[model samples]
Target: MRKIYVIGIGAGDPDHLTLQAAKAIGRTNVFFLIDKGEAKQSLVDLRERIIRAYSHPHKRIVEGRDPDRDRTPADYTGTIADWRHRRSQVFEELISEHLREDEIGAFLVWGDPSLYDSTIAILDEILERGEATFEYEVIPGISSVSALAAKHRVGLNRVGQPFQITTGRRLAEGWPEGVDDVVVMLDAQQAFTAHPEAEIYWGAYVSTEDELLASGRVADVAEEIVKTRAEARERHGWIMDTYLLRRRPTTDD
Candidate 1:
C-alpha cells in the first residue's frame, strides 16, 4: 500500500518547522504542491525553501495549477466545495501517476491540517472515491492562531473562560453569544471593525519577515489596521492574517 503524509509547515517562518515535520520531509519520496499563481509567489517561494532545506536530495517534486474560483461568490460555501473537489481531482491524478506502490508522498500544509486548511479533507475525498489507496498521517505544526497570540503576548481567553475561533464572515454577521473572546481568520471583511468596543490583537503574515502587528481598542486602531492591511495586501499581492477580539466585561457580569 502507498503511504501519504500531510505535514504542517507552520506559519511561513522556516524556523517554525517542527522536528517531526523535518523528519517526514526527509523520508518522503515525492512532494506535491499546488501553485497559487504569480500573485502569491512569496508563498511558493517559502514552500520551495522548506522543501529544499529538509527534503531528501533524491525526492521528486510535482506541481499542479490551483483551480480558479470566484473570490466573491454569492454562495460562498457551495463555491468552496466545488473548488475543493477540483483540487482533489488534481491531487488524485498526481498520486496515481507519480507515487509508486512502495513509495511515500506528502502534501505540505500551511498551519495544522485540522485547522482552517482543507488539504486533509481533499485527501479524504480522493480516498472515498477508491481511485487511489493510501494510508495517511498528519503531523501538527504551529498555527497562525497560536503565532498571533504569541506575537501579541496575550492569552486567547480569560481565566476559566472559553474562546471561539471563527471566520471573518461569521464575525461580521454578529458576535457569537456566550463568548467574550473570539479568534477570527480568513477575514477579508475586517469584521472586527463592526464591534468598536472590543479590544483587538491583530497580526498580518505572523512569523514571517514582512509581519505587521497592531493591538488596541478597536475604535482607536481599526482605521490604522484597515489602512495597513490594504497597503500590505497591495504590496505583497496576498496576505494571510488572523486576530483575537476580547470583549470587556460589563457591570451585569
Candidate 2:
C-alpha cells in the first residue's frame, strides 16, 4: 500500500525543519507543493530551497494549485468543507499521475499540519471516500505562534492563564468571550480594529529578512499595520502575517 507523509516546513526559517521532516522528504518518491500563481513565487522558491537541501535524487517535485473556495459567505465551516473537497480532487489527480502502491508520497506543509492548515483534512476526506488507500503521518514543525512568540520575546500565555487561537473573520465578528490572550491568523480583514482595548504584537513575514514587527495599543497601531501590510503586499505581491492580542485588564468590573 502507498503511504503519504505530510511534513511541515515551518514558518520561514529552513533550520526550523525537524529532523524527522527532513528524513521524510528524503524518502519520498514524489513530493507535491502548492503554487498560488506567479505572484507568490517566493513560497514555491522556499519550498524548492528546502527540497534541494534535504530531498534525495529519487524524489520528484510536483506543483499544484490550492483550491479557490469562496469565503464571502458567512458559512466558514461550509467554505472549508468545500475547499477541502476541491483540494482532495487536486491531490487525487496529482497522486494518480505519480504515486505507486509501494512508494511514499510527500507534501510539505507550511507550519504544523494540526494548525490552521487544511492539507491533512483533504487527505482524510480522500481516505474516507476510499479513493485512496494509504497510510498517513504528519511531522510537526515550528508554528507561526511559536515563531511570533520567539520574535516578540513574549510567552504565548501568562502563568495559569489560557489562550485562544482564532482567525481574522471571527475577530471581526466580535472578540471571543473568556479569552485573555488570542493568536489571530488568516487576518485579511485587519480585525484588530474591533478590539481597541487590546495590545497588539504583529509580524509580517516572520523570520525572514523582510519581516515587519510592531507592537503597541491595538488602536494606535491598527492603521499603521493596515497601511504597512498593504504596501508590503504590493511590493512583494504576497504576505503571510500573524499577530497576538492580549486584552488589557481594566479596573472596572
Highest lDDT model number: 1
Q: Largest TM-score belongs to which candidate?
A: 1
Question: Model 2, range 1-253, lDDT digits (tens) per residue?
Answer: 8999999889889999999998888888888888777888888898899999988876788888977777576887888788788888999888878898899998888878899988888888888888668888989989988999999999888766778999998888888787788999999889888887799999999977788999989889889999999999999988889999998643222
Per-candidate TM-scores read: 0.98, 0.94
lDDT of 2 at 34: 82
What is candidate 1's lDDT per residue for 159-202, written digit by digit as tens? Answer: 77889999999998999988999999999989999999999999
Q: Candidate 1: list runs displaced more than 4 Å.
A: 250-253
lDDT value, candidate 2, whole model = 0.87
Clashing pairs in 1: none
Estimate the overall C-alpha local distance difference test score of candidate 1.
0.93
Question: What is candidate 2's TM-score against the reference?
Answer: 0.94
